[model samples]
Target: MDSMGKYIRGYVRIRLESPAPERFFSLCVHNRIPLRNLTQEGSCYEMELSARDFLRLGRFRRKTNARIHILRKNGLPFFLHRAQKRKAFFLGILLGLVLLAICSFRIWDIQIAGNRYYTTPVLLETLSEWEISCGMAKRNVDCQKLMQKIRQTFPGIVWVSARLEGTCLIIDIKENDEIPQETPVKEDTRSCWDLTAPWDGTVVSIITRAGMPLVKPGDLCKKGDILVSGAVAILDNDSQIQRYEYVRSDADIVIETRFPYYDEFSRTITVKSYPGEQKTYPFFTLFGTDISWYHTPKNTSEIYRTERQLTLTPSFYLPVTVGEIITIPYEKKSYCYTPEEALELSQKHLQNFLKNLVSENAVILSRYIQIKLTANRCRSQGYITIQIPGSDKSAVTPKEFPDLSAETTE
Candidate 1:
């Protein structure tokens, strides 16, 4: 409270020269006038007092026969009195305060939450159409109405809420959990599928869930061969076969397979060699339009790289972007590699090929690599044996199954 009073009422340093300066100080204390940093400088007493108290000190000075002189004036009231004489400075200050007040009521940022399948751009576009975008007045937004509109526009969103947080608008959304019913085959359909071998391999393990296993462990199978049957035979009262019902087959089948890869590398190749000559082009972008500040190269063979820098306010709001394009000229040059270099290149190519061939579920059982060197080239052959999961589903063709009743009657 004392600090605030000093700021509002201002304070002054005064030097008192009198025969009885101590009497003046004692009178100030008795009248409850605050004084700070009181000191005596050889017949002259110096102290600080509030501007209001300084005005009331006239009577005390006459009674104590003291001469008081203000050495300095400080605080907001004194500053404002000095500023009143400068018209332009005072106008600038007033305009700045008005601008700040206007910015406080305007929205400068919009944020989204709980969105996955929908993109932020799409949601922002929707909000823009609804007049809820950045720079709009917060008082104009109706949160409940906007939430309803969002839920209606995006049917996948089950719930939505909009609220204002300071100068930003926050939108939260929730999506529906139910799966869409547009699949080609429904889970509850009478038509069934069978699990078949996707490649030629030996079955190492089989786990059946809803169908009879057609291939057991250690059985060799070919591509398109059914590992589990979708049809189950029902038994009759007399222990004879009755009828068959189709069901979806579910199972896991692991198989052992061998994959062979071969790669070759040449001893001679063409490479691009860059010259020292280069050119740069700088530009600025406002909104989405680019304004170039320098000339760009027209050569078709020029290699270039672009670097962009976006200009943003202290709050991280982007309003403009700057970029530079650096172009370097190059020429094609023919280079020949040594035998050792050719061998390394061939091995690197084979390693990349093997990485692509291997899958996450594959377990490497054995691997072998053979390198051959000719006069101008090196060749690498890789053989890898692995155990991988091999379960797949293929649609059963109707023609593959004949009418059993007709065959029995014939």
Candidate 2:
């Protein structure tokens, strides 16, 4: 049949004291020692010899005490031959692993450019949340899903791109343009109240850009108060005609706001006990799509959640991620209340409230012993003034009100 189980070809290695390995090989052949595979090793003769012929050779060298042993035997030469042939395969596998490692390290150093609104760190963090992270296989990542996630995370990034260059991932983004402001003209006398205050507050100081101010500093007025008027009925030297020009005013006002603080909490704890029970299943489907060759689950009073991913091939399936599960069980846990425990809980809640309120950049202007905690609710309000610089340009169009003509037809 094949090269396996052919003949019992025994190999012998001997050191001839008098002659060289070639001379010894000739002598062995002449003596009809049935030498088959022969070779030289330094001053020794390595050859394949049968048991009977080996005994005869040993008899000739009995006085000299020659060294000899079987190096190869008749059975199967497949293991050694196949092992020799697999060198390239093993080398390829090693190179593949090394390349993968290098790619993994290089992929982490992602750089982003053309990003005006979004920072690199912010985009990378968002990508990480969607599982499109470094070290993850490029084939497994979805480009469309990543783009959608980016838009969802930062709507300001109008357009962006995610691509790999050699090993680094790059993101490009563009931002939207800002809107321009508009101001009204104060040359029209009828437009006095038209140039009204933006909000209700006491007038601090006014800077008239092109028109005279009606309200001075320290003047308290409502929201609709007019600071600058556009109406100008001034007479011209040549003709007693009135002229109008645009005007702007900058004023600061005070306003009021309110904020509230409340706490509503619920908590529960339990101790669980387990009863050891187990069973094995020949096969099971994971992720509702993968078939597990074999699996077993232990019975315990625990709420367990398990997830796995498998790669299916034509003949067999391999596990991508297996044996990652956690159990959170409910138990008969009891809470004993003591004076110290109650005080601790109350103090902790108070501390949490203080920390939360102080962390909100809120300034506690004043607080009174509001005993009138009207079963309705406890409320807090604030009043502050902000200055809004008015625009110095006109917003009205140059086109005057068009005249309508009527035609009488017979």
Candidate 3:
């Protein structure tokens, strides 16, 4: 048998003191008593055997006239004998298991995956709207229904998968990145809108697809000035105003403009330096209750870093979060950035600002920034000329645009 099998079946270590221990072994062989790890000292012999065989050794003691004593007893029976007195400890363990079992059937956490455009809070709000939330029974959550309901609620969500994983509801989503073609266009006269200039800039390019273009290339338009008119005037045979038709303004207009950029920061800052002193401690959180063995001093300044969670399953995380945290002690010191360093940092910030503009489909033409460094401050002020989308849709007022029916037409 293996070690666990021997331990589970119970074993005993025997010490035999006899003039001729060879006689006891010969007798054990004859009677079929297996001995493990047999070792001999000067006069006494030690060996291990099953607890049952130990009981049958009373006859062999008489036949060989050898002394037999149980030096140690090991196994499940012995452990149970010692643990019978600690009933409360065992009861607490059983209670904990029961609690975990009960909690497994109820969701305690929600995990969202494969979402980019839709935020976690937005998806969670949709789930909450459908009466799905943490602490609800897992059985009540139909995965198929959840997938269907989510797909129906968010038209942009092309695919969805919902599953219960170890007291957690995991939802994976795939959003439709392409423009929806099946979307119904709003033809409601009361909801007529116009594309107006969102910024004061000169138009660089204009393409009118579903509305009458009011501004062409090289034309200057101020903020709120209509760049595309939704109210297309219908002229009569004599070129007189008859009536007007309203539409949802749709067009693409790029405008060239200058954006003011200003950033100022102190050269002197407080920085933390680690002195290579860190202590790690294992921690466990059970249903919001945290237990840890390590504690930091009251006057200590340190950083606490938590590692990944420890769990029975590799990817599945339970309500009980187990992990290790390292406490790193550090010292805060005053540091000053040199002029060269400050200038480099300011340029980096400026680069990030221009990068964001590029991400929004804006083309940077030229940047004229003036950097000034004083006793303790670094400042950069300038304007960047760029071509960017300049049109914003707004509901057109009847008084503003001639989209409404003529009073005499009624």
Candidate 4:
């Protein structure tokens, strides 16, 4: 619009008080000078005129004996003049615009989704190998090439989609299962098997489902002894053995096993004395350079310090970060544990050991222990008895029992 053009060049509102106001107005119109919002205020005339048009008013004012005074000013020229006066502010605005342009054209973040078999770091490493990394120019990246590279590198990744979104490289992936699923094999279809004892243990209970029980409850079974047999003798109507049949041995056999435990630790202990106060220091980073007010002390052992970093995004962290460090001062002290204290500590350790065994499906039945505490060492020795279900199966085919061909009366 013409109004916009007038504002861009700058405009001013002026008042006219002249002996021949009609002659001044006629000269402006005849000269093709634009005047806007012309109004009469008693003995004076007011109007808006372009800054350039106002320049031509000097000659008209002299000829007509009129006085011109500016009442108000607006437009782009006035703004530029003000900006020029504050050099640092104007420079900062220019730098901000340049940074925005650079960031928009460069990649600052990368996102990957729908991946299970392949880890994020692994994919990123592959991208780095192909010259695709953060801060690269957007135009330098070939999305189709990247997709092909990913698919070739990992056969498990069946499909890949790569694209650019803003300053981030977004990758969507569809991965095939690392291990193929197969039909479940039936237990009875396996060759004849016999459940054997892996170590010496007393049988607490035995429940046979598909085999003959070789050992009963409260019987001692040594290592390599068959607890359940896969061979069963078939009988005729007269209760005489006719032939032998073999089956897949299966049973739930509980055994009570003894495990010796011995643990030792230093009696000397560490203690901490705190001042009950803390100090915090804040810091800021700009363009990878950090500006902080924190100072490190010579005796860092007496100080416990930690820091929390502030990030712009949850996944993609920028270099420009603001954070604070908190430090607490404390003193360390060492002392030896008493006999009673050592006993209590050793008891706690035993309970933890039992918990670990329980986590592995072993039931803690009972334990017997003795504690020995000295000036520099604490020792606990004991034997733990636990109940564990036996699962070890060994083949006991007909070849192993060729001598048992003699038939017996059932």
Candidate 5:
């Protein structure tokens, strides 16, 4: 406690010179003046004491006839006193502290969580339109109103919450699971749907869950051909076919298909090389506005890139940022590649093109490639035969069953 008081109020080291130094020490002890690190040098005494106690020692020094001189002064009190002489420095520090305190009340960061189908940027944009973005005052944010607005904006969101955690505003959301609606069937009316082929391919496998299969494995089917029927024949007690009961058809079908791709590349490529001359522009960004602190370059053809560094608090809170824009001039040059280089580049391009077609359930069965080289260009054509799941109900159409009673009577 005493050390802390000394640090706050300040302390001074003093040298007391007197012919009767022992009497001076006795007077300090009798007067209850706190002294530390006391040392004697001939007839002089040196020690340190708090600034407040040093002021009160004047009366004791008069009685002991000791001349006291301060050797050093330390702590916050002295430092502040020195800073008081420089008005600009003092006001700048005061202004910075005031700005920091004010900025602490505003939202410096925004975070989103619990989102799957909805993207974070989409949610943030919605929140921004609702006046709940970074740099906005925290007191102005109405969590309940924001939640209601979010729910109204995205109907799929089942639950949402917006709250402030320190300088960051966190928005959490939950989305409703998507469930497919089943088609209804009535006893009086018979409604059936046909599962048609999506493309011209040979069927590799089929699994029917609620339908009668019309196409089997190894069967060649054309596009829009029915692969399954939802109509089922109903039997009576006399072993005769009665009315037809219709249902929604469900099935999983796999098909083998061939995909072809073609690409062409030139042997010569154009590349840009940087020159030596460069210019930099420094700027300070507050909120979303940039205040330039340096002159901007006038060269429009120069390539430029921006780098930003944020000024943050000790705890990693960002309220303002500093940025630099560096501009460099470059010259474009063309370089011709050898045949081997062109072949390698074309091979890499072909591999990348084929990689984009691969899926988690797709299996490659066969691949064929044909490369042709001209004087200045190379052309490559390739095709891959892959087996993939091809269950598509887009071509399905509902059909009404014909009345069997009328036909039997005829």
Candidate 6:
């Protein structure tokens, strides 16, 4: 027992030795081979040779041509020559431990911002519906799908994002305020509500404060009808006086409008292959890092490669974006339009525009084309009277009126 630690352990394979079985056993036992473990396969003797006695045994057996290998000092596997297998296992374990520690300490608390209408509980519930929860793997979450779900549930939400920081989820949201939904009302006595016009006609309803109905249903009222009830009451010992107040008035007024339609009008309708205008991506760089993506033009003009690239860092992004870059050689192709083609294109464009306007509640009784031409640029002017069905209940009214009776000196 030479402390087996002081000596290196190795093996030798003696092949084609005559009287194989007896000779091999005799040599192994006499040489005092580290035969603590041994295996035999046909004529092969797998023996462990200690470093200290290996050289001496080699000299004693001159007939045997042996192979000697110096095992590297670092941990090596039992059967592998010059193998870093042990080191590999150790490194893998280390990495796995490190990852586990990180996961254990990661942020699991989520914070939400820019949420006024929706309480934290409500938003958290919505996120939970999307399978986005605290302690979940960040990379495993489908952000786009969650965003879509939020949009579906809350159509008033303009934008939303969810990210994991450590073990905490940071949810950011922006609400669309263009179409004013009902906001939380405060108990302010001075706050007043907006009063809009009712119908399109002459103003026959007038009331300063809350008291009585100033105009009836068929009272020839127009837009901006204020019917009896915005005046505040104050009681004195001898008299009662009207004061500032909040009021709303609904009125029905008759309106007379005219529209003229003509078969001829100057028209060069642009057949837009896309809707609206394409946005451009913003570009910025700082300290050799991109603060923003390079601004590029969207190739909406071309029929191919209209892709979108989202910015992942330096969050300021342009509303516009350019399409993908492409190289294509082509000559200009133009076509001439006949009168019928021009007229048809113009009619379609006008019809679509009118449809959109009507969808927004604009009344177009009739339209007339005073002039007609065929060019890229055309001017259109018409007289239109819109009849709004709501009345202005606001107590505040504009006092400025045009001086229609003044004579012009020029």
Relative to the true structure, how large is the alpha-carbon lDDT of every model?
A: 0.78, 0.49, 0.85, 0.82, 0.78, 0.50
Residues 273-387, candidate 1: write the lDDT tens digits: 8765777878776545788756555653464546453423333334245777677767788888887788778777866766765645787788888888887777878778888
Q: Which has the greatest lDDT?
A: 3
Q: Give the TM-score of candidate 1.
A: 0.66
Task: For each candidate, give its TM-score against the true structure.
Answer: 0.66, 0.36, 0.57, 0.67, 0.73, 0.37
Which 10-residue span in candidate 3 carries the lowest summed lDDT?
398-407
| C-alpha RMSD values across all candidates | 6.7, 13.1, 8.0, 6.1, 4.9, 15.0
Could you give me the TM-score of model 6 versus the true structure? 0.37
**RMSD of candidate 5 to true structure, Å:** 4.9
Which window of ten consecutive residues has the lowest lDDT sum in model 6?
310-319
- When sorted by TM-score, best at the front, the candidate numbers are 5, 4, 1, 3, 6, 2
**What residue runs in model 5 are displaced by over 4 Å at the alpha carbon?**
6-11, 27-34, 49-68, 74-81, 165-167, 178-191, 195-261, 265-269, 275-282, 292-318, 326-330, 335-337, 349-368, 382-410
Worst 10-residue stretch by lDDT in candidate 5? 392-401
lDDT of 3 at 181: 80
* lDDT (C-alpha) at residue 313 in model 6: 37
Pick the winner on TM-score between candidates 3 and 6: 3
Q: Which parts of model 2 have CA positions greater than 4 angstroms off?
A: 1-67, 70-195, 198-200, 230-241, 248-410
lDDT for model 2, on a 0 to 1 scale?
0.49
